[model samples]
Structures are given as structure tokens and as C-alpha cells.
Target: MGRSGPAACGQTVAYGLAVGVALAATVQAAKADPLQDPYGTWTLQAENDAVSTLKGTSDQYYTSGLRFGWTSGTNNQPPAISNLNSFIWGPGTQRIAIGLQQLIFTPRQTQVSQPAPGDRPYAGVLLATVNLISDTDVTRSVAGIQAGVLGSYAGGYQVQNGFHSLISDTPNRGWSHQLPNQPILEIDAGRTWRLPLITRYGISADVLPEVSGEAGDFRTYAQIGGTVRIGQGLDSDFGTPRITPGLDGTDAYKATRPFVWYAFAGADGQAVAYDATLQGSTFRSGEPHVSKIWDVGEFEGGAAVLWHGFRLSYTQTWQTNEFQNSKALFNFGSVALSAKF
Candidate 1:
């Protein structure tokens, strides 16, 4: 079994490489046509969304022994969640676009503390453990508009697959990081309204079609859902954090800027509405499987100066009312970098 694991990973890598090469070739061939997108971009990011410890009060420093809990019916500890999302944007000439995004997070820490003034003085001491395993989430998409619909109708397809456990408490025992053959398919269409206020508002609807595949004796299944992202570009830094572990006399290696910035963006560039599906399904493989849907709304802004091919940027994103399984609510902040070509 140990030997087979590496072999399977190698095959997966090979398959991904083949797909990437094919995509590059197709795009290059279409470059001669005006219908292709000229907006090419690649960004590397370092993101950290550390959750505040389970405390007794909002403004106090008290602690709790029962820090971790399951979500409603689920019976597993919550997994520490963080994401390193990377993507490329190409707005084709035909009013269409394509994007590829990958989100990965690993090296999680789970710690708990005992109550103080107990029978033992060391009872209040903190006991924490770190997990070295890594998880990856990847998505590849291709979308376009109908050439004869007056450019009002547009739709595209996307495929997503990954091995990240959805569990929040028991991060180590969540699920076997298997490359299930199941992949999701998504399609969306909408109409754009260019307002007189120099703003564009797009109203769109999305759908997901379920897909199934065979992976030996264990069958893989995938279901579809839809999400809408009302995005607006910003050009200012609104109280963004400028300090990080690397620059604060820590031994951490230097990483790419922890935020993405847009020179043409304005203060009113934050996204107002965002929602999605398929986030609430519990895995039934063997160990405890939990699925919780999430509806998230966020505000973001950034600013920076450009020199040569590189730009220094600072950004901040605040998420609120993040719901899972319609039961629990949580929120976190994320910082990332944006590199433009």
C-alpha cells in the first residue's frame, strides 16, 4: 500500500501536466484571433487566516477546556482551515473570460488547555500538537459567450477536485486524502447592465450538474451547486496590516507579498454579495464525514506602487456571517498577493 501511494501521486501529476500543456497550446493558437482574451495574469500568494483561540469572553483572557466542538449533528472536531489560492485571469476579446484557481493549506495546529487552580497546578497548562500533512484544492475552468446573442448571454464550464478534509476539529483523522475520480461541472449565464454612474452590474444565474465515475470498487460521486460573485475593483488600502511573521524578526523565509492590489481600483470596489453550494455534504467513507454549506460576504481594498515588473501591495479582506449547514456561523480574514503581466 505504501508503494502504491507514491505511484498513484505520480500518475496524477502526469495527468495534470498533460492537461496544462494542452490548454497552453490551445490559447496560443487562438491568440491570432481578436475573440481571444489579452488580459493575462499570474499571481503567487501567501495567506494566513488564524482563528482566535476559544476564549471565555470577547474582551477577556479567560480560556475553555471544551474548545472544539462538532457542527450540529456531526461528531468530529473542526479542522483548522487556511487557503493559498492562485489564479490566472484572461478576458477574451469576445466579452468572455477564463480562470484557473488552486487553493492549498497544510501544517495545521490543534491545541487545548486544562483549567487552572485545579487539583494539579500543571492542569492549566496548554497542550498542543501540529500536523505536518498537506492538503490541496484545485479547479480549472473554460467559459465563453454566445457569439450571436448581442453579447448579453454567456456561460462556461469548470472542473474541481481536491484532497482537503472538511473536518474542523479532528484535522488528523478527518478522511483519507484520496484522489476520488468524481469531478463537479458548473455553468452560468447572465446579462450585464452598464449604469450611467460608470459602473457595470451583471445579474447571472448558475447551475451545477452531478457527475459520477468509477474508481475500482469504491465509486466516486459529485453533485453541482451555483454561486454568484459581485466583484468591484478597489485602489486604496483601508487599515490593512503591514506586519507579518517574516518581517517581524522571525526565522520564517521571505514570501511573496501577502496581498493583491489594483491601481485602477477605487474605494468603492468591495464585493457586496457572494454565496455558494455543495459545501455541506458529509463524507460516508468510514470515519466521521461532515458537510456544511457556507454563505459568505466580504469587503476588500488595497494600494501599492509599481516598479519595473514588480509591485508592492497591501490588502485586507473581512468576511462575515459565514454559515455552515445552516447551523454554525464563523468568520475570518485573508491576505494575499497579486502579480500582473
Candidate 2:
């Protein structure tokens, strides 16, 4: 949990090197259209269970993500509606996207001290996702689906602890670790409606309803929820707001205004049938044996702003406890920056 000045400097240098490599890759691939579309976007996002500061205990995790997206300019084929296409690849305004994500989880000192034989290990997950998003109206209405795989790597605990030491300014106290290594399949869909009356006052409102599910060693459950947003609406697609990065294609570039901003809030509930992290299995093992909590809920609020072609957003979320005997409620924050070309 503690970090030395030299270690912090090393982490910074490493991050800078990563950014340099990404920039170089972008330049090298500039001539090739990865998405085969004229319109494209790139987004970078970071999420952490620790908001303003890092803590050693409950719900300690960090995630970093990058996404690339593209939209088709013209509909060359007739719109088709099928379970696979509707969810995997929307029928209307065709769009496709890909994302890469890294997640790390750490245990609290309390848990480490009173380990349950073989529990409380540091874990890390790496994921890659492919998504499809579309808008029939090309503005207000939108839908999307995403699929991805999650994998675990060695030395995740050590690597993450080093980063945490830098953030919390505490030296790393090594601990035992076990993480799930599995492939996950996910699918979801949503629709958004713009409120007509609010538009007259330079403010806009919309409601979105969505449902999603995941299958793998990580989780096996289904989720459904709705969200309402009110803000300065620019012509764009209604993108689902979540801690994880995904596709959010829009026609905002075509808007008359050069800047756009908005504030949003939402609630979602989940029926957790199974969670590998809590209830260990043959594939993955962990401590503090847990019972399946069928009901879980979350509340979130956030704001976003877009100027020229760059967009920035921030959100704060409070989550209900996930397992029994869990005393603290989980809270986290997410920040994202994106640009359209």
C-alpha cells in the first residue's frame, strides 16, 4: 500500500511509454481504415473504486480502457431484424466498435491479516470487446450490443500493488492471490426517447431502458434498468452511461453548435445468480464464502461536456453491498475523454 518516490517515478515513465507506443501505432495505421468507414472515434477512460483518494479496503479496484468506433454513412442494404443481428449488429445506422480493458482488484489489510487459509489474493483481468451500435433516426434513437472475453495474468497482484503504492503513498504489503481466468459472452440492447417540450428552452431530456447478461467464470446473471437524462442536448445518439467503456456513436459532429454539455442520473438493479469471486469453484477460488444475493442495486449521477471534437465526462456511483456480512456500501467514480474524426 506504500510507494517510494522512485517507484512512483518509474510508474509515470512506464505510462508515458505506453502512450507513446499507442500514438506511434495510430500514426502507422493512419492510412488503413481499421473500421472501413469514413467516420471514426477514439475514447480513453479510467475508473477506480477509490474516488479522490485510494483506500486499502472494500471494493478496491482500478480499470483502464480504450475504444475505437466507426459508423457507416449510407445504408446500402435493407434493415433486417433478427435476434442475432438486432443485438449483435443493429439493423439501422450500421456501426461497429472495439475496446480493450484492464482491471485489477486488491484485498484490504484486514482481510490479508485474517486470511481464510487460502484467500484474499490479488487478481487482475484483461478483456477485449467488439460492439455494434446504430441509430434508426440517426440522432435521438440508438441501440447497441457487445461481446468480450476476460483473461487473468500472472504477477497481477505485484503490478497492481506497485501502482496502488504510487496512488496511496503506502508501501506494498504482498499477499496471497487467486484470480479467475475465463472467457465471457455478453449481449445487451437499449432504446432512448427525446422529450419534445424541453428542447424549446435549449435543454433536452431523454429516457433509456436497457437489459444485459454475462456468462463465464466471472459472473452469470441478467440485469435490467432505465435511466433519465436532462441537459443541453446536441444531436447525438443516446449512449448508455456505465463505468466500463463501450461504443457511443453519434451525429453530434453535424450539430450547429460547436459545444455540447449535459447532466444525467440513473438507477439499475441486478439479480445476481452467481459470482465466482465470492463463491469459489473449481475454475476460481477465493475466501469469505458468500451466499447468492439475488437482488443488487446501483445509483449513479454524472455530467459530460463536448467542445469542437473532444468530449469529457465524469460519473459517481453508489452500489449496494454484494454479499452477506458486507458492512460498507461500494462507491466509485469514472472519467472519460473522447474525440471524433
Candidate 3:
């Protein structure tokens, strides 16, 4: 029906999956390690709204994101951080991660330099985060803290327009009305449990359910959701690592088979308390703002492949509107490369 509709979703995911499968040809299978050991993996991820190959969708609202993260080997974490995490989340095998990310958002109409009334506000955010996670075969607990800045310091304008010029795409002209600079601090934690459904042949299936909360200037919300995944090596890791405000897993994983693969679908709903991008500057007087919707939902589908110790993943996401009178379905794609040592 629409560019962000199911037809587009299929084409987008089909295009998204090509690279991961291609990498499978380059890797040779080996013996998998233990099922529960995930240590020393690094992940690099990038997300954008330009994944069409079918019907191109407009690049607006959560248009771009980049993240890099590393998880520590089990028991090789910072003592103070790991101890505090174990104390709060309860004892289990523990690892800590460090991450850096930048995200950019814009209004539906980018044709004018001035702000579009009744549209999502323009905003940019950059954050550095620390995460500690504990795991057993069937359950996982995680806690995280992030600090960063919003607005120009995050370089939304320069990065977006620079890339646009490079690709000869239409320039986004609304950065003049972007949110004012503000410091941001956020903290979040959650727990997820795995329910084994069945294992047939070398393929298996499982459901991962979770509950989580976040609070601070960046965003405040409580969420509940679950993921259903099927493929080979279901016991290799928790789920998939993602930048949140939604469901996500971690990069930490070990080789449970010489070659591993899986496809997944997940959905989540959020009861939002506040969202800085939609509500505008926290402490400043003059900034763009919009009427925000308190409830939002997202649907996602994707796949991952790991050969030897290297992993590759692709995910496509569709989100409900976040602001008043918005037409966007928030279609986006995430591609990630990760490796375990």
C-alpha cells in the first residue's frame, strides 16, 4: 500500500540479507565452543532509512545512527563495575561493554530551511555508554548508563548535509530550527528469559522475552516485548545487539557451531514518560518542539550469520508514529559486523 508497507519490507529485507549470506561463502566451518560462553567480541553497527531497492522511502525522523561497542571476556571486567552489577542484577557470569554512538532526527518536511509547524523537531544526539550484563543459559540481566550531548555538538547538520551533497540527494534545510544544545544523561536496565520451543535437525527455535525501563533527559519509558527466532545454533547467544529505546541484544557471543545462522522477528511497545527530541530543549527557552504521542510500537525482522568467530547481521524495523499528525512509518535498516576472539 505504501513504501513502508509489507511489500517494501520484503524487498528491503531481501536486499539487507544479501551481504551476510555472501560472507558465509568466505568462511570455513570449525568446531563450536561451549553453549554459554560469550567473551571478547566487538561489534560495529550502522543504521539508516535509505534501504529501498524496492520503493524508496523518505529519509526523515531517526534518519541516521552509528555505533561501536566492545564486550569483555567473562570475569575480565572492571572489578568495581562488575561487582556492582553482580550485586544489583544478581550473580551470574558477567561482562561489561563500552559503546559510542551518534543519532540524528529530523522533521517530515525538509524542503524549507525554517521549521515546519506540526512536525517532528530536528535533533541530534551523541552518547558514550557503559553496560554490564550477566548471563546464564536461560536468562540475562543488563544495566547501562550513558552520557552525551544534544544538538550542534552532535553534528547533525554537517553530517547529514555533507553526506547528501556527496550522494547528490536533496539537502535537509531545517537544521536552523534544530533543538538547542543540552547535556544528556540516561540509565537503563532489563532482564530477558529464553524459552526453548524445540530443536529439529540442526536447526532450533526459541522465544526471548524482556522488560525494561529508561530515564533521563534523553528519554524516559517502560517497555515490554519478545523475540521469536529460528535457525541453526539457537544457543550461541542471547539475541542481537541494538541501540535502544526498543528491544536489543548484545554483541557478546561464542562459537557454538562451526557456522551459525538465524532469522528473527520481534515486536515491542513503549509507555513513554518523555522524549527530549519531541519535547525540545530541557533547560533552554527557545527551541523547536512538537506534540508527542505517549505510546508507540515497533516491529522488526532480520537475520544473523556467524562463521568461525565472525558474525554479520541485518535488521529492518518499522515504527509507529511518535508525534502528532505525522505520516511516517519510520522504516529503517540496521547492518552490523561483529567478531569474537
Candidate 4:
């Protein structure tokens, strides 16, 4: 599929916005104010994975049409590898946080030789997988991070040690499709400690296995970062507590709502780095250990608006890594709508 196809670049933007909007509306209501039962859930979907070739260091790399799902776990523990989800908190909203893991079916192509002089038919099969998500609340004085983990396995029906397969073959069009399942897992977590400084900023980080499977012989990295409030919370451009609608346009109510604040609104940009090493992974297939390590960094900025329980927001993610010698880049744009009950 083309990079701009419905399942590629364009799709990521569409979903990112959808999720952002939903979060904005929820946050607007609880801006700076802690609620009694501030809790909710949001689904997590993988939009796109775009990578550019870094001439000297890394080989051409990329993965597209990722998994889609909700989360299954607690506000504290990492999201489960299973397809399920519990509570979901918002990044902008301090109310509550939530996580998700979604299972999606992907179609793979197949080719066959025809006995006659005619074009052979192309067949495809479904690849089912589980995704992870983590959403938490960030109040004016406190912030909490979430995590999600996914590991690929086979023969899950058996209990003992049968759940560690990295490859599987299924019958399709009278042919066996041997698929190497990449066991990818993610660890996302964040915490905000109150500081004496007038400006409030807290560090956050996450870890991921660089190489699939072979846990012991794998690459791991962690992100260390913080976010700061640009000015006095009350004096930010978002608004002065009251909704000031525009003179023209229907974009009413101009107040820095909870989750829905424009890019560079009251909060400054956040910086995170990927710091990990190769440690090898455990796999059912038992291939020799693979060596993998990732060194990447990202700068993210966002703007959002919220009214009642409705939200709309936009966030841009700029990514750069050291693995490939040069630079590999990608961005995130999302739109979402949801309620907080």
C-alpha cells in the first residue's frame, strides 16, 4: 500500500486527532481542579511506523499497518499482552488515567503458480495480534504515567511453556504461510514530583525491547524527560478562567479547558530519550540470540480545545534516533471523541 493510503500515513493523523479531541474535552472540565471520581478509558491503535534510511549507520527500516486495540491492566501495572482494557486517564486532564490493548486482524499476501497459461490468483490470510495502551492524569501539581506490554507467542492453549512461539504457520490456499511473529513489548511509565521552583516540571520515561524475542539477548532503552508550565497557570494564553467566544466563527468558548489546550498552551514542550541496550530475548523457536539496540529521541508539542465533555486536539511528535548513524523521523496526529462517566 502507498505511504499515504488509508492504512498508512493518513490513517495515523486521523486517529491521533480523534483521540486527542476526546482527551481535550474531558480535561477542560477538570483543569487545575482535582475531581472526586476522575476516571475513564480510551482505546489504543497503532497508526503508522515510518522510517527513513540513515546512510551510514542503520539499514533501511520500517513497519506499517500496526495493531489496533484497547488496554488491559491497572493504573499502576503495565498494560497486559492480552486484548482488554480498564481505566484510561488523559495526559492533559488531571482527572484520571487509563490504558488499553487491542487485537487486530491483518491480511498477508500469497502467490501461487498456475498449471495453465493464465494469471494465478492471489490469496491472503489474517494475522491476529494484541496492542497495548497507557493513559494517565496530570494535575497541576501531580502527574502519573502509564505502561503497556505485548509479547508474541504461540500455542497459548497449553499452560506450561507453550506460550512462547515467535513463528507460526497456518494453512492458506493449500499452502503453509510461515509467519515470524515479532515479540514486541513496551514499558511506559511517568511520575511528577512537586518542586519548590515556581515552574512545575516532571520527568517521564519508557522502555522497549529493541529486538524481537530472545529476551536475554535483547536491546533495551529508557526515556528520561520532563514538562514545564511556561507561565503562571492563571496567566497562560489558554484563558483567564472565563469563556471568551470569538466575535465571528462558531468556535465558541475561549478558555484553557482541561485536556484541550492548544500547542504550547500553558505547558511547555516535553523531551524524552530512548536509552536501552541489547540483552537478547526468549523465544519458542529458539533461534540463536539476536543483537539489537535503539538510541532515539523525541520532541512533542500539542494544542487542544474542550467544551462540556467534548474534546479536539492536535499533537506533533518529532523523532530522531542514533541507531542508523543519520536521522530517522516520524510524526503523530490524532483526533478522538469520548465521554467521562
Candidate 5:
């Protein structure tokens, strides 16, 4: 895999747009408005489809992901970001983040040496992202840009097999036919609105509805969803952090009390336009890929605990099959930890 490819032109444009969005709006970001001091926060998140671990086997289909991110304080953002965000959103607090992410996808038959007929091909993605979030108590808007690699260059073989070996699990034998190496570029943005339902006697509840999308050579889709949460500090933030193309969340949460907790559930539907993972190589001419199902649905439930500046959260996701002739339903788990500065 190399840096330049047939999508080179699209890559350049995506990079330029991402840079512009970052410089103008700041990055993915940190802190509730109350914690708007000069300092920021750091967060680490992981997603795995290890549900089959109990059976001493590996699960497949959008299997694993890891991301480390940081967000700036709600206040004290750079002048350029503040100005642009204010212009675009009409007066709101801003936070920015720059982070790296990795994702791995595989078919159910990882033990097979050859590609599975009519099944998704092996794929891996590694990317760097810049995110900017603007918030008003009522609504939050986000914009992000990402650039990186898809395929062998993403090190799926090393990371996946290494981890599998560590756990005495079978290594996926189909890496040789993984999606060819290619550059990936995506521009991501979304908006979320808060609707407060209850706030009294140290308990709070609210609804957050959103519409979002991503566009690039790697993937492009639009989604609509909402989450309802009931907890101690409903003002902390919208929801939990997600890998992408799904629900949205921030690494930072308001510290309303010494301890806080919440339970939440959400659902969404997607209309996918392009997915290189299913379509195979974006730049290469010949590759193996499965027939794609244009519409997909997903729902998730989770809980979180917030103690002062540190937050721990976990989510379980269920999604419909994304490929034609495949009736597999994917179940994955994601965990995230964050610390405020």
C-alpha cells in the first residue's frame, strides 16, 4: 500500500477541508461549560466484538477499534476557532480535539485461508482526526476531518494476530486478501439538540436528538437518531463517546457533584451511499467485495459513572447485517475512560 492512489485527488481535497475545519472550528474537544478553565481532558476508548469469547472463539464484522482523544476546555479556545464557530453557530462555547483511531473488520470465517464467498472482505483502517464541537445549552454542533490508510498499511495483521496470540485464540488466516492499501479521507459533521424532561431533587433526565453524516472515499453515510438518559448530572454532556458513523459523544463531562451516574438507550437508521470496505479498493481495479445493503439499523444501551474529573462508561451495540445474502447480526462492546485536566 502506498500514500498516493486513484483517489489522490479526492484525498487532497478532503485533507484541505479537514485542515480548514480544524483551524477554523478547533478540534473534537473537552469539558462542560462549567469546567471551561484553561486546561483540557484526555480520553481512551476501545470497541470489540468479543462477545463470542465465552465460546472460546472470535466474533467478526466490524470487530475491533481503539481511539485516544483529547478535548480543549470549553472556554479559552483559540481566537480563530472562537470567531468561526460563533459565526457558524451563532454564539456558543467551543472545544477542539486531535486524535488517532484504528478499526478492524473481518468475516465470520476468519479461520479460512481463502476469502469467503459472498462475505465481507478483511479490512483495517488507521486514521488521524481533528474535531471541533460548539455548544449551547440547547444544541451542540460538531465537525471533523480524518485522513489515513485502509488495508495492510493499517497493521491489522500485527495488532489482531498479536492480540489473538496473547489470548491463545485462532489467528485470522485471510489477511493476505484484505482490502488493498489505499489512502482514506472523510469529512464528518453533526448537530445534536437537548430536550430536558426532568431536573429536580438531585435527579435529571433528558432527550438528545441528532442528525449527522460522513463523506469521503472510505465511507459516506447519513444518520438520524436520539438518546434518552436519566442520571444525576444530566448537564454533564450529551452522551457517551462512539467510534463514528453512529451516536456522538464528548470526552468531557460537567462535574456537578462528587459522584454521578446514568443509564441510556438509543437507536438510529442509516442510508449508506458508499463504503469502500464493502466495495473493495477505492483506487484499485480488481478486488474482492460483497454486495452491500444500502440501509442499516442499529440500537445500543449503556451506563456511565462520573466521579469528579474521571469518567468510565461502557456500551453494547446491536446492528443489522450490512451485506447482501448475509443474515448476521453484529453485537459489539465499547468501553471508554476519560480524565479531566
Candidate 6:
């Protein structure tokens, strides 16, 4: 088997989980007070398009990421437009957080060998994000902005190849399929509405509607969707709960809990107006003899658990075929672990 195969994909995810577990253990042993509101958080996330046990030797892509976040009350406020701050963070009670993230992506054997041209290649990304959150009796919402850069020098290929070498008992070497350098920018806003029916069963349920846009060297697209979550508290767009500096005075709506968990499901559709990888552009030339499918849909379901400020979530996603000639229906698994301190 080549570098990009089901076996290689599985190895990548296992390696990521091993690293995450070690990090989690280190954090759990720290002396931070669990009862106090968290001033910061750290997260580890992984995504893989193929699992040998789930589906045999199919669509394969691997991604692993790590992020660190800091809240405003525990640190100085980030500079922003005065009016923009006032609009998103209402006067009542609010939270602001900044995050730094790193992500790596690699193509598989199936992807590289496919007849379709312009398939995504090995790449890595570094990003910074700012989020504004408001939680009150009458309203609950979040808005965010992100900026990032992607390139071969980001070391995605090196990481993946290193893990593969260790697992396959081979020496580290180079692989084909990679993307050109690029910059990314995005902004989004969303609101959640409590569902009265679910509250009767000791379940906190809500519907979230959101809209977002992105402009970047790789792709440009806009998305609108709604998600219904039946759980203990509101779920963030990225599948976690928003942690604030202060808790609501009421016992029914405390900000932090000793243990919490929820099940969630959602769907979204995207209008792909531009894709540098698919449609040749100035930033990067498009692949030859490739099929371009402009519209894509994604259906996702997942569950999350939180205990003593530690959170773990698992989500499975099914996405419609992205290319006209593609016979494979893309599916992937997402795992995220986070801790508050």
C-alpha cells in the first residue's frame, strides 16, 4: 500500500489520540481550582475520512489539530471596534475568548490515484480566532472571526510521514500531492432558541441558526443552516459548550457544572462559489480533467460529555459526493478533547 491508504489514515488518528491523551493527563494533574470559572482552555481535535473497520479502503484524508484559548476576564481585552464589541457582547453578562490553532491535512492513496484532477494535497494551517459570547435570560448568541495561513512549509506532510514511518517500520521520506500557499479569513454569527417541549423532561433543547462566509486563497464559500440540540445546555457551533467568567445566579442556569452531557444533530448546505483547488485561479492552478460540483451538503450527529471542566466529544459526518464523477460518498469521524482551567 502507498503512503495514502486506509492503514496510513488509521495510524495517523491513533497517533493523534496518543498525543492528546498524554496532554490531557498532564493538564488534569495541575493545581487549578475546578469550581472557579475557567479562564482558559486547551483542545485537541482529529478528523479522518477513512477507518478500515468502518469502510474498507475508501476515501481517505487525515487531519489533526490543537488549540489554546484564553478568556477576557482572566486577561486583557483584545482590541476591537468599540461599536462592534457593544453589539455582540451585550451590557448584561458576556465572555470574550481568543484562540490559536494549528491543523494538518494529508491526501490518501485513493485520492491521489483517482482519475479526477485537482485533488487536495498535503497542507497545514495556522489560525487565530476571536469569539464574542452573550448568555442571558432573553438571549443567547455567539459571533466570531478567524484568520489563518496555509502552506506546504506548515509541516503537515512531515508530521504524517513521520507517524507513518514509525507505524510501518520504515524510514521517513517525502510524498506527493500538496497545495500552494494561501491566506484565509472568515466571520460568522449564530443564535440559539430554547425549545419549551424538551424542558419538561429535564432536557434543555434549542435550535440554532447561523450564517457564515469565508474568503481565502484556497476557497470562497457562504453557508446557512440550523441545528437542533436536545441536551443539558446550549452547544457551540464547533460542538462544545460556551464557558463564561461568571455563572447565572439561578440554580437552574448555572454557568459551570460538575458533570454535563448532551446529544446533538444538525445539517448544512454549502454554495461553493469559488474553489482554487477545483477551479484554476491566480493563487493556484487548477488540476487537469477534474470534475467540479459546486453544491455540497453535510449531515452530522454527535454526543459530548463534560466532567470537572474536562470535555470529550465524538461526531460522525456524512457528506454528499463533491465531484461529479466521484463514486465515493465522503464520510469522516471527528474527535475533540478539551479542558478548562
TM per prediction: 0.30, 0.68, 0.87, 0.38, 0.86, 0.68
Which of 2 and 4 is the better model by TM-score? 2
Lowest-sum lDDT 10-residue window in model 4: 242-251
Whichever of 1 and 4 has more lDDT, that candidate is 4
Q: What lDDT score is found at residue 241 in candidate 5?
A: 90
**Residue-by-residue lDDT tens digits, candidate 3, 1-341:** 45878989999898878876754532211111224453588889988887532344566788888899988888677678777987987667788889999999988788888867888888999999998888766677889999999999999899899999998988988888889899999999988776679998877999999898899999999999999999988777778877787778788787678889999999999999899999988897556788889999988889999898888988888889888888656788888899776
Off by over 4 Å in 5: 1-37, 51-57
Residue 69 in model 3: lDDT: 91
Model 3 lDDT at residue 250: 80
At residue 45, candidate 4 shows an lDDT of: 28
Residues 131-241, candidate 1: write the lDDT tens digits.
111111111222211111100010100101111233222222211221122222232221111111233553212211111111111112221222112223211111122
lDDT of 4 by residue, 1-341 (tens): 44755668678988899999977864664344322223343322232222222222111111122222222223333334122333333332222233332221111222232211211111111233222222222222112222322223332112111212323432222112222334444433323322223434532121111111111112233334333322222221221110000000011122233433332312212221221111112344432122222445555444445545443433334455333332345333322333333
The deviation in Å at residue 306 for candidate 2 is 1.1
Best by TM-score: 3
**Clashing residue pairs for model 6:** 4-109
Task: Report lDDT per candidate.
Answer: 0.23, 0.52, 0.83, 0.28, 0.83, 0.52
lDDT of 5 by residue, 1-341 (tens): 76786698789999999999865543323223323545588989998887332222255778889999988877677788777667766556788888999999888788899977888889999999988878866668888899999999999888999998999987889999999899999998899877779888878898989999999998999999999999887777778898987887767567667888999999988999989989988787679888888899989889999886888989888889799866555778889999988
Query: Residue-wise lDDT of candidate 2 within 1-341, one digit each (tens)?
Result: 87879989999999999999987764444333222234566667666765523352334523222234333333322344334345653344455455665665544442343443333334555555554444443222333443433334533555555766778855434344354455544444444433223565678776655555555555666666655677665444354344332222232222235677777777777877776555654354444345546788877777777777677777776667666644355666777776777
**Cα deviation in Å at residue 2, candidate 4?**
66
Between the candidate structures 4 and 5, which one is better when assessed by lDDT? 5
User: Which candidate order results from sorting by lDDT in descending order?
Assistant: 3, 5, 6, 2, 4, 1
Flag the better candidate by lDDT, 2 or 6: 6
